[model samples]
Target: MLISVIIPCYNSEKTIAEVVSLVIEEIGKMKGYESEIILVNDFSSDNTFDVIRDLCDKYSSVKGIDLTRNFGQHNVLMTALHYTKGDIIVGMDDDLQTHPSQIPILVRKLNEGYDLVYGKYPKKKQSFFRNLGSKFNDFTVRKLLKKPKGLVASSFWAARKLVRDEVIKCKNYNVHLQGLFLRTTKRICNVDIEHRERKVGKSGYTLRKLLRLWASCINFSIVPLRLSMLVGFIFASLGIISSLIIVIRKLVFNNIYLGWSSIMAALFLFFGVVLMVLGLIGEYIGRIFLCINNQPQFVIREMINVEEE
Candidate 1:
């Protein structure tokens, strides 16, 4: 059996070499089959690609993929999947935190009759807001995808090549791995894996980045748009009831409709609700517009590839 380990790296100059070395020493010697590492550089502005080149030079089995530009992590991984040649493939963060030590365990689980096996970090180290955002995102994903509650998802995993093909076929400018995880198949499992702190540059994911990710993710799920519809109905009902009261007071109680200000306020409120509902609906429509246009998710300025023997 051949295992293909894919490490997507971007500005991870500090810890990548060590992580690659660790995987080579600890996980590459497992029984039954051999393993090779495929490190993809997502157009980093640092010496990351050079470092990967050096490593590839030192280790003949190591493969290096250089993206023309910075396609988001998921995109980078998705594209890199097409180049992988292994019976079972593993994807992991280039940072040392993902723990290559678990590669053998993950592959072992895959050998025992499982389509996909992912890592579950005992604890996520991030700020309160960051953690909260991730959990909320996960909750939204589970509900939108119609899965059980608290279904955990992670980056590091081992899976058949077919599953990766399905994921790559799914095209979207904003791709969420967690959503694709469920969309790929109903048979997915997670195993406890060791986690460690980043031993290099700070994480690229920030609050603004998280929000962008959320916006992209939510568009794929219809749950939010459904909630928007329910809200529109409630607001419309309230608006109708309010108008009835105004009419009743004007006809029965007189003297109460004595103000142009109230008339203007009612018009504003009515149109405001109408516009809001339209805006909500338009969000979904806009995605349709983009997809119909068939825009490219990323532009490839140049490519770096090494032919396999």
Candidate 2:
């Protein structure tokens, strides 16, 4: 069986070569299993692609792709999936955090009749803010994507080629791999693994980028839009109830006065809710517009040791 390992490289020129070597070494230890490495450089501002090219030259089974721009990690993964030719596909990070040593655990779990296997960290080795962001993302996926309970999803995961084929069918501008995975199959399991500390630069994800990635979940679910409607209904009911109370008080006590501050506060609260709901609706429409315009998920700049089909 051939196992293809897909990695999305950012500015990881320092760590990628070692990562590839370790991946090769680990797969070499697996009996009856061959290995292929697919590295997609997500338009890193460093010499990341050059390192990937060198690895491709050194290893016959290694493939490299260069993106025209930084198309986010998930998009880059989708691009790599198009060129994968392995029976099983494994995805890991460019940074050593997802560690190559844990690949066998996911692959072994996958052989247990599961379509997908995620390498869940027993204890993540990320900063406080990154952990917080991950928690929020996990919650979002569980609720919005209908992810199976207790099935943890992470960067380090293995899936069958059928799952990969289904995932790559998603041509939307926004790519959320977990959502796509859940949509593809429910035969998913998680294996506990160690998340190593980063020995190179910090994470490429910023606060803004994290939020944008979270927003991509909208492509797979309408829960956010439904929540917006629910919130609007609740606020509208509150407005009606408050107005009734004010009218009753005015009728019962003629000397009672409605303060300008209270009226302004009510107006501000209702208007804020109204604008928020509008903005959420606008976001949905904007994404639809982009999809309808045929937005490209990713544009490949170059490829090494990969053939276009």
Candidate 3:
């Protein structure tokens, strides 16, 4: 079996070489499987492409794909999927947090009749904010994507070639890989893996980027829009009921008072609900516009050790 391991790199110049070497050594230990490493540079501002290019030149099995610009981690992975030619595809971050040695565990699960296997960390090695963000992400995935209970989505995972092909078939600009994974297969499992601290710089995901990723889920599911509609309906119903009560009190008992504070509170609450519903609808429309325009997922600027098929 040909095993293709894809690593999405940003400004990971410090750890790229060592990470590649470790992946090679780990895959080397598993005999009877020809290993190939595909390092995709997401237009890192550092010399990450140079390091990957050098590695590609040194090792025939190592390939380098230099993206035109930073398309985020998931988009980089999407582009890499088009080039993978293995029976099984393994994806992990450029950072060494996901140790290469843990890959075989995912592979073992995949071999036992699972289409996809995620490497779940017992204790994720991340900052408090990052962990919080991850929890929020998981929650959103469960609510919006209807993901199975207890299914953990991690960057380090193995998918059969069939899953990879289905994923690559997706052409929309806003790509949520976890959503796609859950939509594609129910035969998924997770293996516990040790998450190590980063050997290099911190994560490329800033607070803004993390929120952007979360917001992009609007393209994948309409649950957000539906929830917004439900909220609007509930608020509108409450408003009508309150207005009727006020009118009845004024007519029958003459006890209704047009208090400025109450009026202001009602205005603020209803306006907030309206603005929220508009924003959610706007997000869906915006994603549709981008998709209709055919936005290129990721532009490739250069490639090394990539054989033209």
Candidate 4:
């Protein structure tokens, strides 16, 4: 059996070489499995692509691709899927946080008739804000994608070529891998794995990026639109009831004053709700336009070690 391991590198020059070497060594120890390592440099502003080229020269099983720009992690992974030649594909980060030794566990779970398996880390080693973003992401996945209850989706995952093909067939510009995986199949499982501290630069996550990730989830799922409808209905009903109460008070009791403060408060509250709903709808429409315009998922600048014998 052939296994293709894909690592998405971004500003990971410090640890890319070591991480690739460790992954190769670990894959070598697994019996009856030939391995190919694909390193995708997502336009890193460092020597990450240079180190990957050297690794490709030293290791016949190593393959490398250089993207034109930073297309985000999921976009890079989706791009690498088309170049994989293994019967099974594995996805992981360039940092050593997801140890290569844990790969066998993910593969073992896949062997048990699962289409996909995620390596779960009970105690993550990320920063506080990063953890918070992850938690929010998990919550969003549960609500929007209807992911299995208590399933902690990590970056490290293994899947058969079937799932990989299905995931790559998704042609949307806004892609959420977990959402795609969940939409693809329910025959998924998870195994606990160790999470190590970063040995190089910090994570690429920022407040803006995390919010964008959440927005991607919204783009793929109609839950947000549905929730907006619910909110709109509730607010509309409340406004009607409030207006009725005001009218009844004015008719039953004389000299009732609905002052300017109350009027301005009502106006502000209603307009805020309206604007929020409009923004949500506009996001969906905007993504649709981008997709219709055929936005490229990623542009390849260079490729190396792809023709290994």
Best candidate, TM-score-wise? 2
Please, what are the lDDT tens digits per residue for candidate 1 over residues 1-309?
A: 778888888998777898889888866588777777888888898989889888888887787877777777777777667667778889999888888888888887877887788888778765677678778877766777775564577778989877877877777766776677677777778788887877776788867766666667665578877787788788779888987988988999877646899778878977887787788778778887887887556554433445543
The reply for model 2, stretches above 4 Å from the true place, is none
Q: What TM-score does each of the candidates earn?
A: 0.87, 0.98, 0.97, 0.97
RMSD versus native structure for model 2: 0.9
How much is the lDDT of residue 178 in candidate 4?
A: 87
Specify the highest-lDDT model's number: 2
Quality of model 2 by C-alpha lDDT = 0.92
In the order shown, the candidates' Cα RMSDs to the true structure are 2.8, 0.9, 1.2, 1.5
Q: Mind sharing the TM-score for model 1? A: 0.87
Worst 10 residues of 2 by lDDT: 146-155
Runs with alpha carbons beyond 4 Å of true place in candidate 3: none
Candidate 3 weakest lDDT stretch, 10 residues: 213-222
Q: Which is better, 1 or 3, measured by lDDT? A: 3
List residue ranges in candidate 1 displaced over 4 A: 249-252, 255-277, 298-305
Whole-model lDDT values for every prediction:
0.77, 0.92, 0.89, 0.89
Residue pairs with clashing backbones, model 4? none
- Superposed on all Cα atoms, model 1 deviates from the true structure by an RMSD in Å of 2.8
lDDT of 1: 0.77
Worst 10 residues of 4 by lDDT: 212-221
